[model samples]
Target: MRISFSKREHDLLERIRSGDEKAMERIYNEYRNEFIGWGVENHSISEQDALDHYQDTITIFFEKVMNGTLQEIESSVKTYLFGIGKNRILQQFQKENTRLRHEEGVHEHYRFLAEKELNDIYTSAIEKTAGMFSLLGEKCKEILKLFYFDKKSMTEIASVMNFKSEGVARTSKKRCLEKIREEMTKERNGG
Candidate 1:
């Protein structure tokens, strides 16, 4: 690769080669923001992604220069660096796409198993509640079945159960529910 390396760039490269850390830092600061902005504006990458890619790009460039692998470039240093960053970003996207494709079936299968397990738990809890429910007094059972299973209004329940008013039926339903809750709690506590 042939880089139209400027005299300043040549000097910078020489300084870096001579183990000048300040020269490397200077080069890093010089292009960091520009690279990030370019990545965001042109590639639609997040700022953090751009920053990370830029760091990687800089690292790769430093390694190549230090190890004598990248002897020359076919363009300007900025262009070369951007090219590396773009390739890395595209590679990441490709990897994410491949991962999603592989995970789709696994995800669906797990979701199905999760739903089945939830349903089984719900059925078990309902069966337990029903068992406890049968042990209640006939009056309590009738009132609960009418209000819950039959979806009867408070006024309707009051009329059916011969309560004084809708308010009395409401209170009775509340008390029945409280009794069921207490029973369930006792059962849970191994009583």
Candidate 2:
């Protein structure tokens, strides 16, 4: 059964949904510090990580409200913020688990299972990364997929991506790698 919200909490959520900056500020001010403390004490997240998670939770909450998915303020705003923070912390743990599993070699049986799981995770991550490339208005996704996934050389990718020269393609590929690294860091840091 869903918990019931206080009248004031419901009103605050409504104001927040309506894009009231004051209401948003009130909610953030009410919960940010306690959520950060909880993240650190319970989840072992670093101070910076806690801060980032708190901000992300607030952002997600606002997005949910705006998207009309946050239909009922069935709990205290503090409870909702804590719930978001908990989920974000757990997501970080899952990503770390996936990374660690990849780093540590496993037995054949485990390896097969890990490979399958990793492929599923990697495919989803790459699709999201590809979407970002689409937003950049460049052929970065195709070039990167061919170079990395297809294991093609710069010259080959240049031919495919229609770069003027292999040198230009190499430079572009290097820049793309840097961008991917940045994206990976963002993902790791729960951004």
Candidate 3:
């Protein structure tokens, strides 16, 4: 909607355009608090941010007036200033959102790196454990293969391995794991 400026507002703009510093100051002073309050209440902007945007808004208004770009107004000066202030707040929010996204991207990159490193460590440990498996006696190897790769219960393992009982199968599995751990520790200590 195109609304013509009031005579007084038109005169104020003309005076500002003519380098009338007092007229500019009057406009600035008149709108500063109101703009800040409106920004804080309506836009959820903090007081300090509202004040900064208000200053920027006034500067933009003054610049337009001086540059002959703001010759006429379709709204009240307060509306114009508030419009500028709202745009500034939106720009600020966009900037903040962009920064937050960048930070999240950085964090995601680091998380990926950490996950890859952890997977590498786990892969290396599995490779080392496979190598250690080769050093086991045939009986221990058969017992571990039955319990793990064959997915056998302790009763089934004992029956297949000809152990006396499930307890013997459990003991054998425990001993196999302990031997692997001992060998791994020795390799780590450069033994």
Superposed by TM-score, candidate 1 places the C-alpha of residue 68 at a distance from the truth, in angstroms, of 0.7
lDDT of 1 by residue, 1-191 (tens): 45577888878877775558998899899899999999899989899989988887887787666655665666777888888988988887434543345346545765653476665654445556578788878989989877765567899889999999999999988888788677656777899
lDDT of 3 by residue, 145-182 (tens): 77665467999889988999999999989998888877
Assess every candidate by TM-score. 0.47, 0.48, 0.48
Residue 134 C-alpha lDDT in model 2: 67
Cα shift from native, residue 24, model 1 (Å): 0.6
Q: Point out the worst 10-residue segment of candidate 3 by lDDT.
A: 93-102
Summarize candidate 2's per-residue lDDT along 135-176 as a digit string, tens digits.
Answer: 544677667756754567888888877899999998887787
Ten residues in sequence with the least summed lDDT for candidate 1: 93-102
Strongest candidate by lDDT: 3
The lDDT for every candidate, in the order shown, is 0.77, 0.75, 0.80
Q: Each candidate: RMSD to true structure?
A: 26.7, 13.4, 28.6
lDDT score of model 3? 0.80
Give candidate 1's error at residue 64 in angstroms.
0.4
